[model samples]
Each structure stands twice: as structure tokens, then as C-alpha cells.
Target: VDFPLRGEWIYLRSFGHHPHAYDFVKIGNNRKYYSNGNLLSYIFGRVPANIFYCWSAPVYSPVAGVVIKANDGWPDNKVVNLASTIILWVKATFLFRPAKDGPDLDIRPNAGNYIMIQSESGFIAFMAHMRSGSIKVKTGQQVAEGQAVGEVGNSGNTTMPHLHFNLFDQINDPYQAKVIPFVFRSFERRNGNNWESVQNNTPKIKGEAIRKQL
Candidate 1:
């Protein structure tokens, strides 16, 4: 499958070999001076979401499929704060769940704006925390592989702006789906100022930054 994003990006984290729930962010050339390429400024006080390198970057579909779910109504949390993140987590769990059927609207605080596509192979590709009003497709609409879907944003339960992407074999049952292992077609791994070619691999190397092959 294709990487859900284009251009240079940072492979922030991974969820092992099971389903490859890769959290990705784009930092462009910011990696030269600051190790944390995503942040344009030192993270101390209230940091606006726009300063992050990955903020508003476009996200793509890894495979061709029909859009099962799509919503873009939630607004991004303008700033990132550790204290507020914890508080929101608690409220989203203890307070929000009881308030309404959040999963139905795809507005659950855990995922600000999201898209779920059922691939031809029956795997469900889920991309979450997209920028508000940035989604381009609607439910039941067919899309092509590598199609532009939305932009990453600082929404939902995120501490900063980034794309939360994963795939699973849920078929008609998206909620119960478990992330399954997958690999990207190609990407270039950064080694200092230079980059090396990597092909057909899971993005598991920690502290490694990568970009799609141009």
C-alpha cells in the first residue's frame, strides 16, 4: 500500500508489527536545526497549532476504496497544553460519552474529524484528526489510491497537529477492527543530512525521519 502522506515527513511513533498504527508528521527541512522538526518554536507556554510543521498538511488515501465515513465539523484546539490535554481526556471519557452518540457523528473527542474507507480487500483504512472542514469526500463515495482526502490538524485528543493513521480487517465492523500490519511502497530514510532508500517496509525505526520518494 502507499503511504497515506506525500512529501517529507517524520515517522513519529509506531504500534509494532500487528497493525502498524503509525503516527506521522511533516517537518520539512526543520530537522536541520531542531531535532523536533514538527515544532517551529520551543514548546513551553501555549503553542499555537499553526507553528507546527505538520499543521494543515494534506493527507492521502493509501488504497482505492469507497468512503465509509467522513465528517469535518469539529474545530481544532487552537493551542496545545499538557494540563488541558489531560483534562480533556477525562472529560471526553467521563463526561462526553454519556452526553450523546458521538461515534455516530464521527465527532468523538478522541478523533476530531476522520475518514474510514473500506478497501477492496475488505480492510478498513482509518485516518483521524484531520483539519476542520478539510475533508474532500463523503460517505459512499468511491476514491482512488493516493487521492487527496484531507489535511492534518490539531483536533480530537491530540496534543499537537498530526495524522493518526491505521488499517484493520474490520470489514463491516469498523469499531471492533484491530490494526493489522502493513508496509509502504517506498520512502527515503534520513541519515543526518543525507537520505537512504528504503522500500516495502514497516515504519518501525524510532527517532527516524522519512519522506516519500520523489
Candidate 2:
């Protein structure tokens, strides 16, 4: 029942390069800063600034929680192309460098421009991969449900543009957190019909595309 986002809604490119219905990990979800390797390599690279600045083209708040964390001003890194599997391991071993606080290791964590809002249900909705400098609110600010928080863009450890929305039980521990299931109140779920009213839940196939009834 995971509701993609909370508020009035802004259209964003699905980071999961698959079709409309294929459920998957979005682009920025897995990657390192600058080196273009997967999350493992990104962890090794650890450059915080590999993500660059962008802006929210539209605003939408998934919840009304106060800001627990907001990091901005990191620049994105250039995309890269890795060679064969064997080469990846060899190169990663030699090229992998621990992230440092020095000038070269300035890339911030991959949660590029993002907002963590508290939901009335006692959970937090995390919206990541935001355009840099497009965050409209600040820490401790009370955002309304479905309000505009920021626009979608490729900032953090992303290869393209899209919105990364997820629900977490705890903010401090994201990787260890469990994903919460949710539903949209009045959106139409495509059930072979043009506009089927989906009340509480909907199941998404691997490659199906479903859109909310506007």
C-alpha cells in the first residue's frame, strides 16, 4: 500500500528505467558518488559532492513532519562507464578510495536534495533525489499533508532524473529501516478499465504502468 508521495503531487520521471508497472529500485537508489559504480563502489568512493545542484520543478509534501535532516549544496559528479565484470573488480580494488573530508572527498551522502516529513500515522515519508537549492522549507517547519516540499531531479548518486519516495519507521537508520506499505485515497488504479477507483490498496506488477486519476 505504499503511496508514492503525500501531497497534491508533482509528476516526476520514474527512476526505475523499466516500464510503468515494473517495481524496482530507482536510479539514485543504488550508486556511488562520481565513480559510476554500484552502491558498494559509491561507499568506497564516499565523495559527498558527487551529487550536484538542481531544483524542485514542483512541490509536494508526503507528510507533515518536521525536518529531521536536510543536506544541500553538494555538486553531482560526472557519469562513468565501467568495463567488464573482471575489470570492475580489478579497477574497484585499485581505484576505490575512502571518502575523506578533504577537498576531493567533498561529495555528500547520496540523499541529494531531500525532505523527511513526519506523517500523522506516526511514520516518516522520505522524498529523495531532489534538485539542489529547491527545498522550500527548513528544519522544524511544519509542512502540510500533500504540500509541495521540493521538485524532482538527479542530484545525489543518481544517473538520471526521478523521484525517490519511501516510508521509514526511523530516520536515523535508513538502510536498516523497513519499508511501509500505503495506499492513495482516491486515485484510479488501472484494472483494464479506464479509471478504476482504488480505495485502500493496489498491487503493481513488474512492468505495469499505473497513474493517479487527475
On the 0 to 100 scale, the lDDT of residue 69 in model 1 is: 85
lDDT of 2 by residue, 52-138 (tens): 222234646755557665556654333322223234334333444436544333224555677777766777776766767777778
TM-score of each: 0.83, 0.57
Report the CA-based lDDT of candidate 2 relative to the real structure: 0.49
Q: In candidate 1, what are the lDDT values of residues 115-199, reduced to their tens digit? A: 9888989888989889998999999999999899999987787766889888878835445667887888888887877888888
Candidate 2, 70: how far from true, in Å?
2.5
Against the hidden true structure, what lDDT does model 1 obtain? 0.75
Candidate 1 wrongly placed segments (more than 4 Å): 14-19, 28-44, 88-107
**TM-score of model 1 relative to the true fold?**
0.83
Worst 10 residues of 2 by lDDT: 26-35
Residue pairs clashing, model 1:
19-179, 19-180
lDDT of each: 0.75, 0.49
After superposition, the stretches of candidate 2 with alpha carbons farther than 4 Å from their true spots are: 1-56, 76-108, 172-176, 191-193
